[model samples]
Target: MNRPRSTCLAVALVATILFQPGARAQVTGAQVRDAIADAVRHLKARQQPDGSWRSRDRYEHGYTCLATLALLLAGEAPTSPPMARALNVIAHAPDEYTYVVSLKIMALAQADPEKYKEDIERSARWLMRAQDESGLWSYQLNPVNYDHSNSQFALLGLNAAAQAGVKVPAGVWQAARRRVLTTQNSDGGWSYTFRGSSYGSMTAAGVSDLLILGGAVVSPVERGVRNGVAPGCGRYREDKPLLNGLRWLGREFSAIQNPGHGRSNLHYWLYAVERCGILSGLQMLGRHDWYREGAAKLVSDQRADGGWGTIENTCFSIMFLAKGRKPLLVQKLQWSADDDWNPDRNDLEHLLDRIGDKLGEPMSWQSVPFDAPLERWLAAPLLYMQGHKFPEWTPNQREKVRQYVEQGGTLFLEACCGREDFRNGAEAFLAETFPLTPLHELDSGHPVYHAYQDVAPAGLMGVDVGCRTSIIYSPFDLSCHWEQANIPLLGERAFDLGLNIAAFATGRRPLRDRLDLVKVAEREDINEPPPPGDPLVLAQVEYHGDWQPDPHALAHFAEYLNEQAGLRVAASARATRLTPEELPRAPFLYMTGHYAFELSGKERAALAAHLRRGGFLFADACCGRREFDASFRAMLRQVAPQGELRRLEPTHPIFSGSPGFRIESVGYRAAALAENPNLSRPELWGLETDGRLAVVYSPYGLGCGLDGHACYNCRGILEADARRMATNVVLYALTR
Candidate 1:
């Protein structure tokens, strides 16, 4: 009643608003992916038949926890077979060691805590009881000897469990933080025992513990880094002890071993370093590539069967190599279109999986409707959109897209089902979105193609899409390809391309930053290497049985790659035969025909050797001919046992970048109508080895389109799209 006496007084009350900070830079997704995949390959190969990975001695709970955590961090879902099995092992096994119990708590916490609510709370309670009066833990719970190593694990598990809604006494955390801070040595690091000489592993552990406590004291050195002041520009600031500990780790950084200690717990120490870096958002430990350099050491040491000598070592290495356990989430927009935008698209998960696999981080996929602010999704590193035709946006909606692009957002647009109307609509929308800037083709030398992998540039023809800043547009039906593929790995090129787009969108550098780095490198070089020269040479295989269906095809491709794609080309495509000697010399080979063909034993051997030595081959049938298909499959089986044809996915890099482009298949239109109606996907198959495509083949005719004069002669990918595909293949071969 008093407030009602003055309406103005009631209106005077205001709410305080806080502006969110800009997105922080993330580690290159590709770097994370490669490391995690390598570590996982090692873990999986060594896992026992019972779903446990065993050390030489026994199947330890700690190993099981670590392995599960590693796989979870590497993007394996909780429901995934390996993760489910590992969890079951931990759930069934008895908990004895404090370390084992703590590790299990942490692993379960990363998974759904509610799903394992009783287990997590029970394990967490055990840890609290196990903690020593000194606010630390030791390997043995009953003896109550406090040690930094055990303390770190106890704190980690507690924090994880607490985050999952388990109650941890506030005093327990406070006491632990105080204990760590008080015990830290003057050098800014810690030791296993109180007041001991500071070492790298212990220091990292100490820093990580304090970070979890959220009471880390900021030093002047750290403030300067965070605020971009003198003494620390372009670096993140951390708490004082953290700064000191990190400084100590940096000073002692070694890829071969953990700093400040011998190699006894090298992998474990490396894992600690990774956690510290991730938590602190530190990109580099001084000047060393902490993730990459560390990965090389671990990968080189991995056994052929894919495990370290011990389960603990394997788990530690896997966790370190996979980075931390944080999961990345990617969202795709759901919008109005001619085709059903929310069609059953189960295959899309594979794309997310590939991205996660490469980055060593798990990815959660979401579908966001357009009703909300676009920024809600754009705030993410990447967003995808696919439909046959886009509905026209209101003026307000258009502004949202504009802001999304201008505010460091990336938009991926694909015209589904190869619908020209959709492609045209997308172009119009783009034009309206950024009228001042015309869409331009990317050059082959663009960093996007080579960010994580060297990608082939699409030759002269406009492929699936073109890019301008944060936007990528394509007319090809990528969803169809993703939906139809059986093997997750087959459509790597499409994924590679998508990754490039995402990388560019999320982490695009300013032109000035690039130039500055270049200048710095030039100034620092002791011996300058000359820049790469021009006049690139590509060799093609001239094999038996009409391999050169369109003799002019090579010349057309050469011209496009040379002039339009920004490469200096030789006069003609270098020709080679299937003989061992010639095959070895042809790094990029093209083989195609409608007739059956045979290879001599020498040729087969040479072909196998060529593939092993990193040669790439592109084969196409002239018009869906069974004869060429049968012969090529037989020959591939002979040349490489691993050369089974797997259908290409839509996310392959071949569909991205300049030399990478997407194409619609003319034959697939008929296939869709005749076979399943839901299968409007053009199919490409690949023979892969050691994670690289050795051969790409199309049973549907690509030769007729390349011939330029025979578009009507075959049921296949259209002429322009065919040219785009050929360009993509040639470029991929040359670079990959």
Candidate 2:
């Protein structure tokens, strides 16, 4: 079940150093978006007046179907004029050729499966009838020979049709799987025809075809019976042919050209690669980051007209980028025996499918080995780890897991079959990894319970890392329930909880195709030491109760200052106590927490003395907690008895763009805006002493926003506005 230790260790080291923040790819998420938009515009402009695109004379119907599928996958609405016209053409098209019929079925199924169900079913029947006696597909019915390309498309079309509630015969899948296994070359690759040598396009086609056929035979719902204790539980081990084919594809991988056949039908090959990678649920093919490399190639290869060579090629490239760039929802941790970690093979897939349906967007998931590098681990926002037995990890592995979680990754642990041993082991692992923070049972009021769907409490426990609960644990059998076809009431609750967890972890933000680039930019600014000079040091005041509720907020805000105002600031804030010795080193002191706290008289006197020395004090309630807000306001009263805290006017320097961004109005989070829709202008309070803005405070949360992530049900200013406000305040403080 586990890879050889030497191989795993070597790959881990190389992956770690290669994908480090400093060595991120040059292509960014913005550039990819621009390229996609350009391609979309090109396709729109190229649409024929008759609502069909013609590439080759004889295969115009197939070309049109390809174009329509590409556009639809790229987020084109079916009701749009271009898509409506295209759909109309496809709906009324003849089903004479196998290629055209297969493409038409896929397009219609994706466009509006329910609305075009009959068309999809009819096309699927045509494809099923066209299958050769040897369980392969050719250009049309009664063909002498069958090719891998045609067979792959036929299976893809049928799969889409099946997903749209069509009942595909099991015999069709069984025969196809058998033939695909038998035809695999000695070198593990596949050829266009049985007599020819293997190449990239055909290999991809072969691998994807097997995956489709295999998945159909042993569906997600049927996978529930494994449950780790059943006979033949090692399903992955049994898939030797699939594994061999993957190894071949990995060995001959390329995004620039079809391997072994340079530049010939490269777009078609890339499309096949996308399908293979997606179906296998893998981020890497051997060592290549397939999506990243492929996206970069496609973006660079685009012509001035925003197309790639021919219309068919353009459509293929578009589909590759559109479908391949889907955000990763979760990565199931592959640790221990494969059966132990993934008893129910399709649990994450099924859960993601439901989540995708709810969001009206495509979501992806993958299985990542626990020994994988930190970069690979951080690719997805959430890491889902489930097992029926205790996970015995080495010291190095444990440390790596700790690093991943601390650096903005959410860990979701579940005990399969409600195993007490796994639950206890998970608790111990969490305790060891985060000694300072212990897992506590989450209450019904916690955000995870209501992030999306409001569900009753199911005894979920979590560990608070910085401003959010980064580690969540469930001592129950959720994965088994997820694998059920017609989920029971308890299974429905499990899905609801899974949805909420995903929403909380991702904040419903679109994950970039290349998240490493963004992470690198942020890390270089926030984690790297400042230049050797007199840099402004933003210090956090250590206090009685949960003062460092957002441990990363100050550093992230310092990064904002460096980026926005060209300020020379320390990469990390210094945590200082309220004493004379430590107070003078930091002219700007930040104070924030979640719980109510009273300052000792000595601490109060020290703060008052610091303010007398012209030092600035800025504070905000973490997560807009009422206890902290009230306590902070009271502390200000006691510290400066004569000064009254007053709301800063819109004309105040912080709001009037004295430092940088103008802030006449700001956007609030949904929870905050729900209660105060009319809230617009900044609502910051200031207490002046000797006509200097000695103290500035916000009752609403700012730290969570400064951390550059959303907190479900958190009442706060949005990230952009909060960053702007923080920058203006820091600039004003330094000058005043």
Candidate 3:
């Protein structure tokens, strides 16, 4: 909840606030929402009854499409009256103009891709046909006049269409890339027309287009600034033309108007500024918030009737405030085998979902055959391969995987159900690939365990090792547990493990420091009561049935909290059944079991009261099974119907913030992977009362992940990960 906002106000035209040390404070999400609401009301009032906005002769289609997009960005549902009206106009209009066709394509793609797929593809075809020989687009369908303004919109539409499943020619993107590269002036900025004097608006548009087309701009100076260098900032430079253009924009940054054109194209300039900053992933431009500053100007400049006038100006202003650009997904690879590498042994869907959830962005997954050109896999930051027996790679394939690992690409290998072939083949491959840097055992001390969550080693199974080159190998079957029931269900620790591996592979170790952690205190007095006011003491909850599957689990976790997080606690976990008398002193109660059990009326009342009194109950099943999972849900319903178990959002504080940890379960059902490979990803569930987490539950047997204890024929999260989750839960409960 206290996350620093990444929003940046517009560049300096309207904003006079100079950048200074400790001067930056993020605009909260709530502020952005309020501004959007006002903008949306203004747009709605300006809409025509026919769902179209007034436009220049023959440009009504284009204006309507643009306005529709703006409304969508302002949180208008696609089916809303205004959006539907605009879509209807687009659907019926004879979209002959190049700009109209292009804008229509984008609007439809965003509004309802499936329902309007045919229209989108047809418009896309028209756009491709309308392009001039110079690989640029003009406003007119076949006009010789071409400029970056028209070209940028065309490219934007094409990109949107491509994502909506419209097949765009590979050559289209290639040719566009070439055109932008050739048009760049020596000064690293573009003009309205190629080779013309450089200007701010056109430069931003140019950079955005190039980035969209996958062109890298070199920054002439580090941080893309030159003159107004923040004192003490280090000097570093990458001389890409794109970077150069950004530097020029930063230097002449303005939210009020186009620096070169002045107020002539103010709204247009703001829209281009939004695209450039967002596409480049820069929150600040030369110490300015391009978005925040631009938004403030637009809000203040709005006409009394809520329209910026000229229809075009209003549309552009809405677009700028909406910040309407989706983050591009980084390419990723999943190495494939001809036979065994398939539906069941795959965690591609789960992995992407986890990455999206954890990173708060979307990710696209691509599959590469085992024998595909090594160059193919090299482009991705992470490559996943899991099977019972990894097919022996051709010598070339072997060399490729090696090079990939050495060149900072990560290769994740998990044996299928502890398959001998996979384990043996993987080890052999490692031996041949890196004879000098042999695979060494990975202990709890490794950076990977504590990358996101503080992980404790439970020695789940087999030998897990890591090489210096961001390479990690697990002989156990990790995918199976993740893909159980085709839905990820192992545990948070399991998900955390997978996410940490991916993050590390991508060179993003947000939680990099491996804290000088001490083992948890396992010295809780089993029979004695806690001393008065021992606020941080952990209590073990005992119930009937197969509880205490891992008798020392709670104690191990309590010790982890004390040692890693420095929380004061009893030497060991205290055990007590559901009793009002026994529960008052402990604010945190931990429980787990492998079988179903019923709670008596008195026990139910006691449990309910404990939770209502600010007590936190954390529980997990010993083995992921229907019986225990069902019973656990039933018990929660009986204890607190309104607080029945529900899945925790990936962004929940428990997953981030205080403990900021994640974990994953490894291994799988021998034949289950093949049977259901498209299930929903695993999740963590909790019961809440008064907006505070009252109970934390995991279907996966987290107990098995403690103390290297193995459950009877059940897979558990690795010890390191289990302990990490344990630490996080304690931290979350105490702090949140």
* For every candidate, C-alpha RMSD to the true structure in Å: 19.2, 4.8, 17.4
lDDT of 1 by residue, 287-375 (tens): 45465567667766777666677767777877776654233344566565212453323334545545664543344444445654444
* Candidate achieving the largest TM-score: 2
Better of 1 and 2 by lDDT: 2
The reply for model 2, stretches above 4 Å from the true place, is 1-25, 216-237, 337-339, 394-399, 509-529, 598-602, 670-678
- Against the hidden reference, what TM-scores do the models get? 0.47, 0.91, 0.46
Better of 1 and 3 by lDDT: 3
lDDT (0 to 1) per candidate: 0.61, 0.79, 0.63
Superposed by TM-score, candidate 1 places the C-alpha of residue 264 at a distance from the truth, in angstroms, of: 2.1
User: Which candidate number maximizes lDDT?
Assistant: 2
Clashing pairs in 2: none
> How accurate locally is residue 150 in candidate 3, as Cα lDDT from 0 to 100?
86
Q: Which stretches of candidate 3 lie over 4 Å from their true place?
A: 1-28, 215-239, 303-305, 324-736
**TM-score comparison, 2 vs 3, better candidate:** 2
Cα lDDT tens digits, model 2, 601-637, are 9999999999988999998988888999999999999
Query: Model 3 TM-score?
Result: 0.46
